[model samples]
Every structure is written in structure tokens, then in C-alpha cells.
Target chain A: MTAAFLRVAILPLVAGFASLALAADIPTAERRSGSEFMGPETRAMQDDDTTNPGMLWVLDGEAAWRRREGAADKSCADCHGYAQTSMNGVAARYPAFDAAKGRPVDLEERINMCRSEQQKATPLPFESQALLALTAYVGRQSRGQAIAVADDARTYPFIAAGREIFERRQGQLDLSCASCHDDNWGKKLAGAPVPQAHPTGYPTYRLEWQTLGSLQRRLRNCMIGMRAEPYAYGTAENVDLELYLMWRARGLAIETPAVRP
Target chain B: MVVLACSAAAAAPGEPALRSFAIVGDAIPDSLTGAPGDAARGRAIVFNRQVGLCLLCHSGPFPDEKFQGNLAPDLSGAGARSSIGQLRLRLVDASRLNPATIMPSYYRTEGLTRVAPAFVGKPILTAAQIEDVVAFLATLQE
Candidate 1:
């Protein structure tokens, strides 16, 4: 081949390599600063520090803890007994496998289970005020306790299922939950920082929603953003996703009904 | 008398109509026009189950749309509050208006995923649709 033609062909090839080198450097350019690793602004909003606005939910939950609600003339107080003593650290080890139900159960599910089995009351709806209050109250008992999701054989399958869902690619974006939350966490998308999808503080009052929602609800929202067909409410998939999130946040303190910006 | 004269001057011919198109930062001047919107069409852009689905973040004037979220601003008087240019900026590229707004730009014709091939170069709403919605908003002025 003529030198001129050879240079012409090689020029485009060199340009292609240059573009590849530029693309490779993009990630380094996007490397997050130290402050970026300290979680997003939403973390501050979810902090259960003494100044949290959602602290009111704890008070409401305490009230509901003592008030009678079921048809059989039973209140949570009748069975669980003074929450401060009986329920301490109970929230830290939940969504565990229940041999009776043959599935994992979170604090909400467990509360409703007790309501139906012992209290004879109708189970409160998910994200309902009553449910929030009760879960907040119960979770508050373990406010300082570190999360301790058991990885026993019985719970392992659900945890695996949850992790699978977290890593599975889905929707129009063809992105997995891990892509943005786990891998790209602390990185800025557009201008807002992405947060690690930890379930340390849940039943959180989100500024985006202007209301309280459970971890399942947040998962569904992420699914919608990914343009994936979200699992229906109360589905095993959602519960499993919640299980995985709780496990990921195993050592983080439980801050239920947390406020988030 | 001064207030009445000022109000009269504000209502003078060409002035009121010009006011309709006026821009004030990012907000509209009037908020009570009474122009009726085609809820059906608006619903397509605002709450279409498979399309615009704006309710995913913003609460709109329509009720009965469950899951009416609140991540973005309320769009009850968006027409009167924003000039066509401002609205165009918001619809074409909201990042230009507010870098942190989670509201997706409906008129962004590129870099969007999961869109049908026919819609690749077209905005979610047509120019006429934007005008119709703006007309409805102009009616909201008091």
C-alpha cells in the first residue's frame, strides 16, 4: 500500500485508540472526592439523631403500643408488655424465617402476624399510619442496637433471592440495582449524588414523596425509574428485596420511620 | 385611585395579553385564568400509564390519579406561572433551568432509552400540544 493510504487508514485507527484512551480516563476523571464517600444528603435527612422530625412517629407508635385495637380485647401491651423492656433489640434481628409462615417476615409482617393471630385485629395496610406508628414504636425499642440479620440455612435462600434481584439487570436502562447503588454509589449522576441502598433507616419520610414509605416502596420507586415492571405490592419479590437490603445494612443502627431529604 | 389606575393600566389592550407571555424568573405572574384543559390529552402527557407518566414525580391538578407523587413541583398553574420560553426550557431540558430537578425533559429527543423508534427524534409532546396546555394555563389567570 502507498504510504499516504497507509497513513490515512492508520490515522482513523489511531483516533479510535485515542477515543478509547479518553473513555478509559473518564472513570478516573469521575473519581469521587472523600466527602462523596460519606453518603448523600438523604443520609442526613434519615439520621435518627435527637433532632429528627420523624421522631414524632416514635411517639405515635408508643401510644399505639399501649392502646387496645383488636376485637378480642387485646392490645400490643397485653401480649408484648412494656415495650422498653420486652422489645429492645427485637427490630435489629427481623425479616427472619418463620417456621409457622414458611417464609421470612419483617417487622411489619411480624406485627400484623401478631395482630391477626393474637390480637384478632385486621392487619393494617402497608405504609398506613397505623402500621408506621407500630413499626416505628417497635423499631425504636432497638434504636441503638446494631442490625443482625441471621444468615442461617433457613434464611439463606431468601437472602440469596434478594441479592439476585439486587444484582439482576432490568428495564430500559438495562441497569442493575448494584450498578448505581452498589458500584457507582457516592458518584454524582447529573448533579445529585447516588446513595448506597442501605436499609438501616426505613419506614422513612422522604422529601421526594413528602410522606413515609417502607423500604419495599423505595425499591418499587427505583424499579419504576429503571423502567422495569415493578413487583406488585406484598409480593415475595419485594419482601426478598427487603431481606437483602436489611442484610446489607446488618451492622447499621435501625432508624425506622426516618426522615429523608 | 392609584391602585385602580394601575390595575386599569395593567388590563389595557395588548398589555394583558403581553402579560400572559411575560417571564418572571421561572414563575408565572397570574394563577387564575379558568381556561379548561383537555384532561384526556393532559392525562396522556401527565399520567399516561405507559408514556409521559409525570405523576411518577410531580403532583398535577388532576385527582383520582393514585400514586400522584410529590418529588417535583405542583403543576396546577404551570402555564400562567411560566412563559412559553421558560416552559420550553423546562420541557426541552429541565437541567438548564434547575440542574438538580429530577423532572425529565419531555422534549429531549436524544439520549433517552426505552423509547419507540418512531419517537426517537420527536418530543413526548408536540409544539401544538404545548400551546394547547399553555392556552389552558393562560385561562387560569385572575
Candidate 2:
């Protein structure tokens, strides 16, 4: 009996080892966005700029971009000059590998980096209205463009780490992100449908939250729901996870300021 | 939701004391409360969102509730599937059955990481509540 049990256990160990050579679980052809699962009202809200509440942040961000700030007295427009032409499709390719930081830096962190280094300004706090507004505005420029994370060796390790985090069970519930998003997407958990968790629409507005929130905020919320210790904002884990999601979401159109219920 | 103590003065109000119970194979043959639970109360608890949260991951034979979950096994015919003792053990801690289960241990409070400050040292459900849930589940023989 012990020999049979050992054989059964060792077979799974071998299979687990084999699976480390990770392939995308959801095929490129089959990947679906979170928007597909939403109600018609919410989808209509995302489709129109005027109806979407997240557009408010986008508008505020547009104003902040043109306004001069910091000791250097430079606005974002001073360096980038016209978001429609220069900033278009930029948000699709983040969190990118940062050579200076020796790690991945998300769009928010990149914005902060530019602020501190170029504008000589204080960094914005995570989830602050100003930061959300700025991220929404920038991300809005990438709307309709496919999410395209850099796929070179520089980002490979971080992406793997993110995948590990997604698969590893944690918290009192012993649930991983994959337990719901991968294993059981399209199923209902209570009344609500479980989304595919594509990082397509962000800084997306959630009706439950009644405000625009970043992808990191959403990630933290899931971790808390799992009863796990959410990493502090701006931590490497969050950025790495963002990178992995962006990579997983490659080919999906950006939908910044997308409305969700 | 009310917890009764033999010596009321020694226990904090509304605080549930965990009773020692033996696990016999895959079941807990003994009741945690030393008395049969009220099935009506158990059914009420199952339907209550704040208390049981069972509907979050289970669907059952209630025609009224619009949104039952599809995450776990349906509560319909659960009594026919599991023995009462088996149901009790599962409510206590399912990780012993399946380590990767998303179901929370409704009656366990230890070894959990990063529990919210307000819920520290408290099981998701009381001992009597577990029995109540078990009794309720045992009635779904169809």
C-alpha cells in the first residue's frame, strides 16, 4: 500500500516539475476581457466617454499634465508635448523593465520617477486622486491599442515570479489567484461572475468602489479577500504581478477608465 | 449567534468556547454542542449572507435566492452525499481533505496569516453554528 501511495505521489511531483516550463493556460485565441462578462449597462458605460465615471479622472489628469509644477517648473507637456500624438499607445507597454531600478516599474512608478528626476517634484502617494487621475489620462491614450509587455530576458524572471504568486496558495482560505481566475473563470462566486482578470481596463472605475482605482488597488483587494497579507503599495511583488498580467493580456485592447460593476 | 456557558461569569459575553471533539477517520461522530442542532435555525443560518456565507460558493434548493454560487458543490442532495459526521468534519477544516480547497475553515481560528484585526482569534462560525450548518445540510437528503 505504501509503495502504491509513493508511486501516486511521485507521479504528481514529476508532473508539477514538468509544468514549471510554463505555457499560457488560456490560449491566445481564447482569451476574453473582463468587459465581456459585465452587464449591458456597464459595457455601455465603458463604450462611451461621457457616460463613464472614470473619465472624470481622465479630465483631471489632462489638466494636471499641462500645469507646471515642482522646483524645475516643468509640466508633463513641456517634455512630452501633446498626449494625442506623443503619449499614444505608451501605456500598453508597462510595467516595463527599469534599468536604473534593476526591476520592473509600472506606469504609476514611471510617472513618479519622471516627476522626481525631471520635474524635481515630490512623489505622489499610491491611490491618491492626483495619481489615479494622471494614470487614467495616460492609460486613456492607449485605449484600443493591444497590451504589449516587453518579452525579452530582462522581464522573464519577474514574469515567472508573478506567475508563481498567482499559482501559489495563500491565506486562511488557501486560495490562489489562479484558483478562481484560471481554474474557474466564468463561474459565479455568490451572485457575481468571476472575471478572467485581464489587466485591460485600469485605472478603471468600479461601481462597488464608487471611484477610479489603479490595478494595484484591485490586486490588493483580491489579496485581502483571500485573507493574505497584501504587500505594501509600490512593492516589487505588485509590479511583478502587473507585468505578468500585462504579458498575459498581450493582444487585448487597452480600456483605461473602463466602467465595471 | 448567542453562546451559552455553564459558568457565565468566567466567559466573555457572546464569546464562543471551542469544545474538544475527536476526528474518527473522515468524520467527527460527536457533536460540538453535546446536543442535536435545530434544523430550522441551521437553514436560517445557511440563507443568511453575513453569517454562513455558504451561498458565496454553493447553490441549493432555494427558489427565492436569485444568485447562488457555482464555485463549489451544490448544497442540493448534500445529505444524501455525505454522512452527518463527515459534514461536521468538513465544516471544521476541509484542508485535511484537500489542501488546495478554496473553502475556508469555518470552525478553525489558528495558524491563519494576516487575519484582519477585528477578526483575530475568532473562527468564521461558532461551534454551535457549525452543528447547525451540519444539521441543516443533513436535511437535504433529496
Best by DockQ: 2
Q: Provide a comma-separated list of chain B TM-scores, one per candidate.
A: 0.53, 0.87
- Chain A superposition TM-score, candidate 1: 0.80
Candidate 2 wrongly placed segments (more than 4 Å): A1-24, B1-18, B110-113
The global C-alpha lDDT for each of the candidates, from Candidate 1 onward, is 0.62, 0.83
lDDT string, candidate 2, B38-109, tens digits: 889999899987788789889999889978899899889999999998899899888767665678887776
Q: Write the per-residue lDDT of candidate 1 for residues B1-142, one digit (tens) a residue.
A: 1111101122224422211222245533332132433534644655554565555556667666666655356778776686654554465456445543345555444444443334434555554454444444444332
Single out the weakest 10-residue window by summed lDDT for candidate 2 chain A.
Answer: A1-10
RMSD of each: 16.7, 5.8
| Top lDDT model | 2
What is candidate 1's CAPRI-style docking category based on DockQ? Answer: incorrect
Poorly placed runs, candidate 1 (over 4 Å)? A1-51, B1-142
TM-score top scorer: 2
